[model samples]
Target: GAGVSQSPSNKVTEKGKDVELRCDPISGHTALYWYRQSLGQGLEFLIYFQGNSAPDKSGLPSDRFSAERTGGSVSTLTIQRTQQEDSAVYLCASSHGGTDYGYTFGSGTRLTVV
Candidate 1:
């Protein structure tokens, strides 16, 4: 892809249901990130993966939130037993490697837990 791509642009699920959001980063990019925005709130970093190093999952709100990157290209964010409070736009971004460069972000997947 020329830029970051995310799947299922929008999703609506009942509370307690699980949902999966996907992201495909630009070719040759070495860094990927997942973020969430609730309504008017600012973006919240959920996780980050850099090259072959261990992923930083410090920002995940709870054990129900998890993510994985396969082959360093495609990534997935899974939320188990969704809660209404989890409703937000999930964003994915990729960068060449560092904060020195701006990131290319996906349009985001809007997840709504009813």
Candidate 2:
């Protein structure tokens, strides 16, 4: 991909259902991140994955939320047992290096839990 791309631009799921959001980042990028933005709120970091390193999961809101990057390229963010509070725009970004580098962000997936 030339830039970061996210799937399912909009998703509507029943409460308690699970959803998987995917992100395909630009080729050769080594760092990927997952974040969510609630209505009128700033972006909240959820997870970070760097090339072949253990991911940083500390920012995840709860155990139900988890993300993984496969082969240091495509990444998936899974939310199990979705709640109303989980409704938001989920964004993914990637960078050539780690946190120090500038990032390219995707359009984001809008998730609505009904």
Candidate 3:
């Protein structure tokens, strides 16, 4: 895809269920990021994967939240034991290795845990 592509633009899951969000970044991008924005709140960083380096998981709210980038192109975010508080728009962005070219964002996946 020319732009970042996200699957299941919207998702509704029961509490305690697990969900996986997928992101396919533009070809050649070396940096991928996951973030979430709750109602009326600013974006909260979740995780970051750069090149071949180990992912930065510091921003993950809990141990149940994790993400992985496969072959440096596609990424997936998994949330185990979803909670109502986890409902938010999960956004994916990709950059060309640094802040120089900025980032290309995908239409986020809106996850609603009920």
RMSD to the true structure for each prediction, in A, is 1.2, 1.3, 1.0
**Residue-wise lDDT of candidate 1 within 1-114, one digit each (tens)?**
887899999999999999999999999899999999999999999999999999999999999999999998999999999999999999999999965557999999999999
List runs of model 2 lying over 4 Å from the truth.
Answer: 98-100
Off by over 4 Å in 3: 98-101
lDDT of 1 at 106: 97
Q: For each candidate, what TM-score against the reference?
A: 0.96, 0.96, 0.96
The 10-residue segment with the lowest total lDDT in model 3? 94-103
Residues 12-39, candidate 2, lDDT per residue (tens digit)? Answer: 9999999999999989999999999999
As for candidate 3, its clashing pairs are: none
Worst 10 residues of 2 by lDDT: 94-103
Lowest summed lDDT across 10 adjacent residues in model 1 is found at: 94-103
lDDT against true structure, model 2? 0.94
TM-score of 2: 0.96
